[model samples]
Target: MFSQSVRSFTKQALQWSRIKLVHQRITLTKFTTLFFYLALFNCIILIALQTVAFVDNEDATEIITGFLNQANVTQDHIIYISNNELLKCKDLPSLSDANCETWLQEDDGDDDNDSNDSKSRRSLGGFFSARSVSVPRHHSENAKTEKYSNGTISGLELDNGKVLDTSCIQSLIWLNDVIHDSMAEDVVTLVFQIWLFFLSLATILNESLPHLGAAIAGHVLVTAWAGYRIRNTHKLREHYQELIVHQVCEGVDFLGAWWDVRTDHTIPILVFNVIAFVLATYLATRLYRVYARETFNRVRASPRLHKIYKLVLVLSVCVQLSGFFTVAATAMWLDKASTGSINRVAKHLVLYRAVFSTMAVLEIPWAILGWICIRSENRRQFWIFAGISVLLLASSSAIFASPLYQFIFQTWPFFASMTIVSYLLILVITVLGVWSRTQFGKGLPEFLKEEEKLEGADFAPVYIPDLKDRKSFDSEKGHGSDIDTEPIASLPPLLASQPLHKPPPAEKRYRTSSVYSDINRDTVKLSSTPPLAQAILSEQSPVSDCPPTPNRSNFETASRSPLSRTPGDRSERSRNSLPGNPRPINIQESSSGRPGRTGLIRI
Candidate 1:
């Protein structure tokens, strides 16, 4: 009784353990699918946030001014530029001739270059400096309002008698210049982060779940924080937009000036995010479905291909790292070595280098994972990167050699396009994963042999199909045929004497095959008809060893059913047969070709 009770307890424990294992597996599968979806969702949110964070002119202006101030542009310079009236002077040369730059020009040399420099400096100074002068008190409300209590006018009155602060116009232009510069940096930063996000997804596709999942989770968390910041930034931008619209609708005093300088940084961000969100959502849905179905299990990549993939990835990482350092060192050198155009070029070089470097660093992990997940379509992304790298390297080298490299290179547009292209490329790559072939081709690595040996017993039961039982079943169903068991009497004497080809060696046969080999063979059927012609024709020599020729009539007679042809039809056979200089004829037929087995021809 005690033994029976213990047995019952053991069986129940075994059943519970099996149930727990199945539940754990199902839970793991769900989590895997969930993480993939989360990764994609994070990317989408980040994109949206990036669009909002960087797409406000007001905020951009603030950042630019702050950056310029940090770069050592003085408060006086900012104030002068902010209120400059250079735009009112249509003819710059005339403006310079009329305005003597009393404060800015040194008047030290008589050289033409010195004179030109003086004129340019004076014109710029004049635009920012208003000709303030002491004025007598006026009774008129407007005149009184314009004059300070100290009896001084604050601004220059134009020929049209309009007082305007042109200094502010200069400030606006300066802000616009810096805004453009900072915008590039913003784009680079966002694009770099985006590159990292997709790269994490790529890793998830290729790496072991536990390791990759932890890495991806950490990355997504960082991205999520960035997204949070972006969302807040969006709110600020929206509030600013509201303020701008409110001021415009109210026809504020500076409405005309503000409208003239209005920058629509909003549209591009909106458009980019809208499109990106849609694409990301679709791709995420597909990715979710892929993981849910455990479709990645079907993908079988060769060990040699994996090695090649890793090598390519390593090469890419090396190239990216090299490019980053090269561009960075060059930019820093140029910044110290020269100014003006060179300075601008150096600034752009540094920004783009930083972007590329950040992306490269993030790409290393993904490239490592690519060994497992790299598909034919993803190959194009790498090829495109290589092409872009070559083009940029050549262009950068050429630009560096040129005297006016900065002015000629126009790095912003080019680098911006490249960043956009990178984003689009990754997006396409992510989407293509859904269509990518997942079935692993047959092959076992050397290490797998040891594993197979250890687990061989466990696998035997699955592969040990009952061939005898299958044959019996086939016979009972009347599907079994004598095609594979046919006698050699039906074959020609020459063909029958030829030995069958030996099968391939075991090692060579199993080199790239699965552990459980499923052998299959093609079945061919042969039906004999009555003899169409005699061995020798009537017209042939009696002792001739050559066989008789089969004419058109013999072919027709052969086409008929075996039952249709009579064994005693000697007259028909004689008529069909022809005197021959023929050797033995061998017939080969395939089901895919000519009907009724008319493949016979004399050699």
Candidate 2:
């Protein structure tokens, strides 16, 4: 009767266990599928953004071509073209030998009624009309006919038979071509695409691998790519500066006319890349420590250090993003030169330059300070520091977005795009700020947390004892079996059946080396040397015919019969006459480094 009752209870327990196992399997499968779909979508978005950035190169090239057309070097817009020897057209010495066709075209009605205001507006507007016109007859013929035997046009012969040097025009054209090609090969676009691809690959890798080393490597590569981008942009900025100076030296007042020389995009690109490279470097450090299996406490000073690091990053991002808006503000302010004071424009320009220069110059030292603060014992102090810093930053933004500067967004298409990008960056930074707060460590991105979870799920195995070796102490006690004859290995079912009782206080901290106990293996050999198991055994009372006090040494020597075995094992084993196995207990330290036995089962 006792055995029959035990078997019935065990059968019901087994049925419930099977149901829970199925449910858990379904849950895990759903999670995996969700990640797979998300990764695919992420890849698509990244590829599209890269394609758009690449297409922007063509737009840049078109802007340059449009600027050159507006210069109208072939037209009688002599005011727009510099009269320097490098660029100026030569005048006819005298019309003695010149035919009517040899004389420059002139129309009395064209200049008669045009006011200075209209001329200035026309110069500011398209300066050159958008129509296909042949190059001037005098200059075009000389340019083509003066070609050397090497097929290179050395110079164009003027109407007076003197040559106008081609070197300056050729150099400017070459620089334009080089800038266009550089834009096409933008490192940001290429790096971002590659980074996203590796990130996508990480999601797939999580399905089978135990670590996200590939994704970590991608971040390191991106940091280097960002540095490369900054170098290229710096070189480009130098070229633009040189061109502006050249134009100024030749008395060309239209220095601001060329979009290539005065881009609202480059400043933003430069600032953002600097910030990103710094952040990526920090990110790589975080990932490397994890990959190397280092403890968090050893890597970082305290919980506060992480918050401080994040705060610093947030500040840098916000400051650099403001530089984008400054560019727009400068453009719009300069556009109102007819109505607004040049002093006001110059003041805003100097202020923006000062702000940008300050941030760029201090970025490295600020990062160094953040690194130093990571070792700080106090965590809450950074919050106070960060709050004050943010308030100052906000004040700076407000200054840039003041009523005086709002006209830029209203005046130029460049500022309009800058306005949109500014808003988008705001949204992005806000989301990142919120997400950073939820992280467990300093400089750890959300993606790394997800990767860690995936890795744990893939590698951490749950141990389940075999049902055949399962023994029920309650059934044995009722069946009049000899309790003394039961092995120590069979005590789990008895301990599991006992009513919940308060565990005794620890005598001392017991530290034991941990090992991976594979669930698929034939046996999990638990060492009785652990004081934790001893404490548990000491709590149990002896029954009739059982030892009054169980000897711990006896359990140490007796080989524990494995409760579970892999299905592939061919060795036959005795089956339990009655019900389910006791739940498996696990004791391992968590990531945060809390020590001692955990997850001991009651049933």
Candidate 3:
């Protein structure tokens, strides 16, 4: 709710700001797509980390359950723990088999000893083990004493009074005291720590490092492509003609343009789904970039920090992965030694849940970075996105840290369900790059944006080639005469009246408006009309001047009369009325039309 409220307030502020926004480049290459892929990949990683976390929680749960059932802690004393009920006999009220030694054998070596101990069987639960018991002395060299119990001949006990006729203990315990310490999670933690250290290095080498290289190369490649695309973007959309303007008393609330991804009725759902999902995801992240930039700038991070950050990030991942694998190894070890009968159902739940819950804890940091990276365009969108991010992270955390998550897998006899979620999450996240590619660490646009935004206030241009009278430069030159007419095409052609060779250097220099304004004025808005049009508008009254291209002079002569028209492009204005190509403008009407200007201008 707090997040949502933030979103609402932020949205209002952003919406207002957007209205005031003058212009922004609408090109795609300025964006680093690696960040988008990273966002996707980060989610995938979270899913994976969540799985490992679940497994770890299982380990914790098993250990906790074991402790609950344990009779002792130190190796000095034996603690017999089981997953299920290990001993049961309803017939004998005072009898119990908590201890495991000295059960009666079928044939007693000494008949006299059997006679003395015969009453003991009736009092005890049939063939019972006395943990602190005396075994009948046997002459046979073959028989061995049971280690867990006292001097007893181990034998199965059958409860005769019950209809089931069952031997009570029904659980499995594989490793005894001899190997429990060796196979425990703490030991596994160390081993997996080693395993994960290497595994993460491998991940870094194969997945991260390669991807980073690909992205670096991709940056150069994409930038080149964008430059190429812009050089020849003459093909305007065909639908631009359909831009029927509507007059609104209050102006428009929203401007939306829709494109049909699938115009045909028979597009395959699989292909459509793929395309739509990708496009939507891209648009969302692109919109997100604006917001993400603000945060990256706030953090004051940079790609230059990648080397150290990568080392640290990899190390953190190594620690986390080690913790994860340790949980898995411990669970597998416990499952083998589990005794279902001795331990209650509640105990199994506890044992498995605790171990796996720990796995979720380690993924929290990655999730945070992801949230920080999945930006929205403005405060409003950012707030909303933040809320969603929080929800995704919290859900994963719940699955990782909560008991409900353990129950999800514990109910299954095998870990098939849990494993699926685990595998999918890992695969998707690694590929997706943690909800945002840039969020993972470095070499990304998120880093780039920060680099751009956080430059020192004491910035100095490389060189200040002092110029003269920019406002005068602006006033004197018409469209053909202005040096900045084709800014992207480089400096405008040499002035017509200026000498072809160097005539002489000027003595004085002056700054136009301010040094900064003149130097960095790419984003400033000029008048909507072209300089040539401005010349026509001021030089000639609204009564004259249409263009004359090729043989369309007669048709345009009538069109230029401004009989009932407004000041719009002649070509655009002629669009709706004419049958053939719209008549070209007739340039013969004005006082200093092309004849007079071209006559005077010569470099």
What TM-score does model 3 achieve against the real structure? Answer: 0.22
- Models ranked on lDDT: 2, 1, 3
Model 2 misplaced stretches (Cα beyond 4 Å): 1-345, 348-350, 358-396, 402-419, 427-603
The CA lDDT at 70 in model 2 is 33
User: What is the alpha-carbon lDDT for the whole of candidate 2?
Assistant: 0.38
Q: How many residue pairs clash in each candidate?
A: 15, 2, 59
Q: Write the per-residue lDDT of candidate 1 for residues 522-569, one digit (tens) a residue.
A: 222224534553332222222212223334444444444331222224
Model 3 root-mean-square deviation: 28.0
The regions of model 1 sitting more than 4 angstroms off are 1-38, 58-164, 184-197, 206-310, 316-392, 402-603
lDDT of 2 by residue, 1-603 (tens): 999999999999999987775444323433333433443454455455445555655555554444343332232211111111122122211223212121111112344555634533443243234111122222232232355698665554445564444433333342344444444344334544444445434434333221233333333444454455556554444433333322322212112333333343444444444454454445344333323232232243356644554453454444333333333323333433222222232335656555545544443343333322323422464444344345434644675554444433332333344445544444444444444445435444433344355445646432222243213322221232333544555669888577665434454322222223324423333533344454544343322221122133322223331111112112211111112322223323233445322322112
For model 3 the local lDDT of residue 567 reads: 38
